[model samples]
Target: MFTTFRGGSSGAWRVISMSPVTGETLPAVPSLSVTHAAAIALPLLPSSNAWRLAGVASHVRYVERNEKVALVAVQAGLGRPEASHAALIPIRKNAAWWDLTQNERRRIFEDKSRHIADSLKYLPAIARQLYHCRDLGEPFDFLTWFEFAPEHAAAFEELVAQLRGTEEWSYVEREADLRLVRERV
Candidate 1:
């Protein structure tokens, strides 16, 4: 299924805050809503809408069979009742990153950066979903959604900080961190 995230005045998620980590920032919006469909017609967004992004929940990439098994063993599902705090971080990497062959990228992602190993410790606590939009010609290459209990917010921060400090992040050209809270019905 394709997932679409809308940032505007309406959504089940209230925007806590949004900040630019690098490059241009997305226009501010009061809330965010997510929807899933077999196919998404994105141009339908109202003219007044601040922004919208869509991507597919594709298979896990950059991991070996053992790593994939390990991830599935420990990674938790999204929307757990007690996990309300969330963040939608959209990132666009520079051409240099895209230029690299898949193998080269994988080496940097894990062997050099240790992205997966470092993140495993925080799993089951911080649920996350990664969406790929580059194929759709979206502004961002990837949209990462993360969820956790309010108390685990600090750990989430640490994860983000650690990832950003990696050599892989040097290829990122644009990134925006949008913090959110699940709106009570």
Candidate 2:
């Protein structure tokens, strides 16, 4: 009864998740502090509705791509509550979004959209990672994972609200928000 996303690039990426509906099993499902999953029909990840759950792990920043997100922007939750609460948000851009020039999209994402500036306020409190799933050919373009303590839950919600209300969000044709509460080992 567990789910596992492909982490650690050893050349092969694995897609392992318990099939809740079918009752399939993954014997090697590791002991996870937090996990999020969506048993949805792939190919078409409709925005109006997407089964979502909470999860963990982060690697890089969306803006700087390979560069790491500023230490001030995310708190690893070391020696604290990294598993207290978590969120996995999947977002897919519309066709028109891809049509835009790189510079144009960057302008909207940074300036008019204010996606970065808005999120800066809630940093460290809400640990997050922006996963670009587009290249992987996953349904969503980005899988943004977030973790925070229960005390900062409200702040996390506010941060999401701010980003969702921005102009860049308009390109998000499909979205799935997975909320998760970690179970103690």
Candidate 3:
């Protein structure tokens, strides 16, 4: 069983131990939200690619709740240019995004929603930072849909780098696959 300790403003962390079943008190591992669980587990899996992609999708969805940035999406691709293109969309809006077809939207949702749902486990904490992650229903892409307060970009960047750099780094390519979208709402 999992025991969660509320850390007040710091949120809750879980303490996991098998000893509970054996009527003993063993040291528990640091409690991790579902996102972190997936992040840490992704790289260790035999199918790292699939897991990493799902991890990225999960991370993206976690960060999408920011109110200042409207939407963000990241996609892995066959070439550096493809990654580049995916990265560039949030920096500048594409007319195509606003013109997406229903099929395209459905494809994006089907592919990305599970990660988003997993990400939602941390929504309360993420919401405290004024951000949320989502999938734009576009293929195997992970989307971060959020908004940033004025002058918060630098801080946001730092926070993102630090968060993504943790055990989840493998799930998200810091330099390539994480996309940011910021807009004043």
Query: How many residue pairs clash in all the candidates, one count each?
Result: 0, 1, 24
- Candidate 3 lDDT over residue span 1-185, tens digit each: 11111111111222221122111222222322123332223233332122222213222222335421432322212222211111111111234533667555434433443333333333322322111122322222222322233244455445445544443333332122222221111
Show the lowest summed lDDT stretch of 10 residues, model 2: 7-16
List TM-scores for all candidates, in order. 0.96, 0.62, 0.24
Candidate 1: how large is its RMSD? 1.2
Highest lDDT: which candidate? 1
Question: Could you tell which candidate, 1 or 2, scores higher by lDDT?
Answer: 1
Name the better of 1 and 2 by TM-score. 1
lDDT of candidate 1 over 1-185, digit per residue (tens): 99999888888999999999999999999989898999864644576468889988999999999999989999999989889999999999999999999999999999999999999999999999999999998999999999999999999999999999999999999999999999974
lDDT per residue as tens, model 2, 140-161: 6666767778899889878878
Q: Global lDDT of each model?
A: 0.93, 0.55, 0.28
Q: Please give the TM-score that candidate 1 achieves against the real structure.
A: 0.96
Q: Quote the lDDT for 50 in model 2.
A: 22
